[model samples]
Target: MDPSMEHLLARKKSSRSSSRTRSSSASSQTPSDQKPREEKSAPYRDPRYETLLNTKGVFLDTCDLDIAVESKNIPETLLQGNQTVPESTIFGEHQFEYACRNLQGRNEARIIQDISRLLVPSAETFAMLGSKHLEKVIESVNEGWNNCIPLTGTRPQPDYSVGFRREAFSNEQLDKLSPFIGNWLSGDLSFFMATYYMYFPFLSCEVKCGAAALDVADRQNAHSMAVAVRAIVELFRLVKREGELQRQILSFSVSHDHRMVRIYGYYPVIDGKDTKYYRHPIYTFDFTTLNGKEKWTAYHFTKNVYDNWMPSHFKKICSAVDQLPSHLDFGVDPLAETGLSQELESLSTAASSDIPLNPAEQQVATPDSSLCGVGAAKRPKKDVCGIASDCSRSVTVNHCASCLNQINAHPASFNIFASRPLR
Candidate 1:
């Protein structure tokens, strides 16, 4: 070979060697030295109690209730007549003893079932009783209140929830009221129509056991009770009674961890244009602390809520409904007369079939949902009517200023309900 050709070949070989050395050095570099791979951002986590309060621009403060101080402070009327078990006997004492004796399993469902079977009154048993007032209210297990805070896209399903039975109100009355107050104003008649028609829900209970933290229970109760109180406030607002609370305690929520139970009263403070929800301590009972003597304390409280609080709540709702103008000032809904029945049927059919009108906006709890986990996935942007169309806010051309304001505030509800057709 020529000497010049041999020199070129050696130089080419040297260049290839340098390239291999550089590649090897890059491969062996520390993570810090290497350009990092782009990470897909984590999904937005679900809002807990405090986070929910901040996000919705609501304030949370605590208050002490007069009746919560002592068992004697409970109204005799509340403690007496309408109880599932006799007022004199200790409620759930035997079951409490049994639970204490057995090595209680950590299964959340079993814990809740045991608690419900022993402590909480079943809707069937309570309703079957001959009592005048008790028969009107019922309890639901693991059913989410459909008419939750419009701002929160997902509904917080409590372990146990209570509301008035639909039979308590006449269909004709609901029919007349559904036109003006239905749709987005879930705080009104639509709440009952939206979910299982468990009208005017006033109480909820959250149960936690085993590895499940009571803190998570509190957060769940907070979101649920807030929604309950807000619905009450919305009803009052319609009747021009929004700011007229004789007592701020509008609703109640109970948190249970085996033998430990805590009760909270939820209320709203209207600060100018915005409404703020506050949680007040009602009572806390630990059956283990007093050698099971205080086992009946929670029973008495629940009885009072069922007997006294429920009647008063129902009365207020009736008064508000009576005050609604027979003819709505917001012109006329084409579906007013037959709307309630048609909508109720449609909702029931949809619920039974388990088919959502729009799957994108459905509130589904992911399996991985934990103490700090994300809830229902983020939904695609919806139009003013909540449909996947290009409907604009200006489409509220027919809606009154007051109606428009409510629509703007609770876009989620309007999106869900506005598209609902009446027969």
Candidate 2:
């Protein structure tokens, strides 16, 4: 019998027992020639039954069922109910609970399956997004910061110094900026920070140091850098199409010894194409740290243009990464080309050959001990029929030994083994 059917049968049996117990306690008084007592004297039944009856319009001022039926909203009514009859009561709570539980389980299973199917593709999409952001940052730096300006002992020097301080925007003021400008920059920045912090919490201080280095006294250079940053931010905003324009500089510090300036800030990101902004977790990493410790490095900005916009651009990449689906399994049919059916057929044929034919064939073959061969030497005389022996009854059949050994030898091969059992 189907497991589901068995479960339903068990539920029905339990419900019937409960119903019998409930009915057994009712008064056995019979109607007689005498007039009935006052209406209030009627025995009270379960409130749940009253609720169900009321819900069915059998005993209430209003009911969803009556509205649906009278309005011809529903094509059919599967349940029948009346006020006095227990079996006629509609909408049993126990049954509804059971159905809800079952439906919830099914929905959870489907969601898990969908996530598994999406995992790898989502990861690849995120990687591509990161690559595009990186490329844009590189382009911005090359176009905006090809020449260096002198910062120390300057006499009517260049307009911008590499390590000078520039004005910074506050969260409230940043929000008041142009929507496109603010959202594009701030959202991307938030995403970058979230990704960084999730992977490298210790790099928070270094990030502030790097951003501080970009603070310049030269307004022209600062404007140019901002423009470059804006362009990259717009690219990501256009693609994601969601997220907030809010920005908050968590901290900012300068480090002349390392020729680095760092700033830590929070920005939102486009979670998907529809939602405007989603605030991701925090992140922190330094571009200068990547120069020598390449392996430990989280991100790289080859040119100063990228360096200026790094915080926001990395936010886009991180958003893409976070949005990735957690699990995936492409619908590649393992049985289609696995040849498992043919292998099973061969095994079945071999097992069948051990079974004795009719009486005539058994008499002709007669108990040939020598023909059993060395492989069967250890077998008992009555069990020399090879596959004819009921392996289920054997104490040492080693049903999973060979498969387990193969899995141990080549771990990657487990995918195939796992697929086989599923088939």
Q: Best lDDT goes to which candidate?
A: 1
**Tens-digit lDDT string for candidate 1 (338-365):** 2444443544353344222321223322
Expressed as tens digits, the lDDT of each residue in 188-227 for candidate 2 is: 1111111101110111111011232223211122222222
lDDT for each of the candidates?
A: 0.51, 0.23
Q: List TM-score per model, in order.
A: 0.62, 0.16
Off by over 4 Å in 1: 1-49, 57-60, 63-98, 103-105, 147-151, 180-194, 210-212, 332-423
How high a TM-score does candidate 2 get? 0.16
For residue 280, model 1's alpha carbon misses the true position, in angstroms, by 1.0
Candidate 2: C-alpha RMSD after superposition: 35.2
Q: By summed lDDT, which 10 consecutive residues of candidate 1 come out lowest?
A: 4-13
